[model samples]
Target: MSARIGVVTFPGSLDDRDAARAVRLAGGEPVALWHADDDLGGVDAVVLPGGFSYGDYLRCGAIARFSPVMTEVVDAARGGMPVLGICNGFQILCEAHLLPGALIRNDHQRFVCRDQQLRVVNDATAWTTDLTAGQVITIPLKNGEGGFVADEETLDRLEGEGQVVFRYEGLNPNGSLRDIAGVTNERGNVVGLMPHPEHAVEPGFGPDRAGAPRSGTDGLGLFTSAVRSLVSA
Candidate 1:
């Protein structure tokens, strides 16, 4: 059977449908999960897509972290289930303590939106197995609070342990420390990033590339990597 990936939709979510479509395009069954629902429907993997959950009240993802569904997600994540968080979802992951560090407002105090280049720093994680180390890919990035911050020790530990999964390639867009763009938990099952990879999975709707109109599809590897990981397991 094909891998079944669940995409959770919290109130104010703007990318659940896009995430589901990306899962479908990646040959996985897309299961719709709700924030208030405690059940995960036995999905092989889960994706928390980008958006302003709870309208970013009291900080981004602060309210969504307490949703009923998050309890199950937290348990499953600790048990080694693959979980990927994007943009606001990344904030949620940190708030729930599933991942370390935090995302604060951009240093420039402005929302950023553009095509971003990232280098895959670690490809052994559930969400990046399809890529190779040092491989660079372009995807869309849009966020107000995208800056990743952590203490010196945590940052050093992440680098030393190879938990820093992705890094900004050319220019750091949000003043993230060490140009960090994404990270994975120690188990590598839970990963979070501030970019919107789901938006770049489809060719015609993705960012434009050199000499190829709307040909950027680097983000597809993330979904496909999860499917491969589930299938192989």
Candidate 2:
């Protein structure tokens, strides 16, 4: 059976189409979901694309966290449904408590835009199963408030339990605590990060790499990993 991956579209979402395209490119059927709608359309997995949801009012993802669709998303995620969140979507996952840590303003107080290198810290998660631990991948990262913060105890727990899925390699762009770039839930079914993986899935249009032609597809592993997990499940 073909895997169906849903990409949610909030009012201010800017990357829903890109996420859907990534899903399609990864050999999964892309289902467009609305924030106000409760239906998931029976997708096997879901992706919350990056965007300025609710105008980033109140707080990033604060308002979208309460959207009607998120109610189902939260429940489904708890039930082991695969969920991936990027950028603002990562913020929503935190607000919903599906993932730990909160995104704070960048230490530099500027919207940083560049291709960032990230190391796969944990390849056991559903969304990162295609990658090998310690493998470095470059992806486009652009955001103003991307720093991740959490209590010391929570940080320790996450690290001890192998929940940290990705870590910033080389230079830390946002001063995220412990150089954490992404994390997965305890169940390993939910993953969230600030980098825009959807933007790096396609070749020629993705971030450039040295000495490698058409090498910009490093982020395609994320989408492929999710599809592989659904198939095995």
Candidate 3:
């Protein structure tokens, strides 16, 4: 049976469709989940796509943390369901306290959109089983306020516990603390990242590439990992 992955759409969300398409491309069923719905439609995994939620009022994802759908998302995540949050979703995850640290304005004070190189730091998570630790991949990243920051203690803890899932390989686009691009919860089920993996799952349409491994589909591993994880579970 195909594993169904839910793609959540909040008000002002623009990449939900992209996330769903990525799930479909990964050989999984895609389920649409609205931000106001209290149910997850029994989807095995969840993807919160990148976009400006609730118009990014006050702070990105701050208001979205209280959305009706989050109640179920939180419970399901705590129960060990895999959840991947991207960009604005990352901010929401942080605001909800599901993931430590907060995303603030970019240190450069500008929206950065580029094909960013990211190194996989922890591939044992439910959503990263297909990747190899320390492997570098290029994915699309776009955000205005994507800098991630937390106390020194928390950063050390995340690093020591292998919760830092991805880090900037070449350059830090938003000046995130320690060049962190993504992180995972203690259970390794919940993950949040600033880059848009969904945008890099397709060839010829993803980030522009040059030579070998030029298909621009490096991000496909993330969705496949979740699908395979659920199928095997």
> What TM-score does prediction 2 earn?
0.98
| Candidate lDDT (C-alpha), each | 0.94, 0.94, 0.93
Instruction: Candidate 2: list runs displaced more than 4 Å.
Output: none
**Taking the tens digit of each residue's C-alpha lDDT, what string does model 1 give over 1-233?**
79999999999999999999999998899999999998999999999989999999999999999999999999999999999999999999999999999999999999999999999999999999899998988999999999999999999999999999999999999999999999999999999999888989887788878765538788999999999878878
Where does candidate 2 have its weakest 10-residue lDDT segment? 210-219
Candidate 3 residue pairs that clash: none
lDDT tens digits by residue: candidate 3, 1-233: 89999999999998999999999998999999999999999999899888999999999999999999999999999999999999999999999999999999999999998999999999999889999998988899999999999999999999999999999988999889999999999999999999999988888888766883657888889999999989888
Count clashing residue pairs per candidate. Answer: 0, 0, 0
lDDT, candidate 2, 124-182, per-residue tens: 99899889998999999999999999999999999999999999999999999999999
Q: Candidate 1 regions off by >4 Å?
A: 211-214
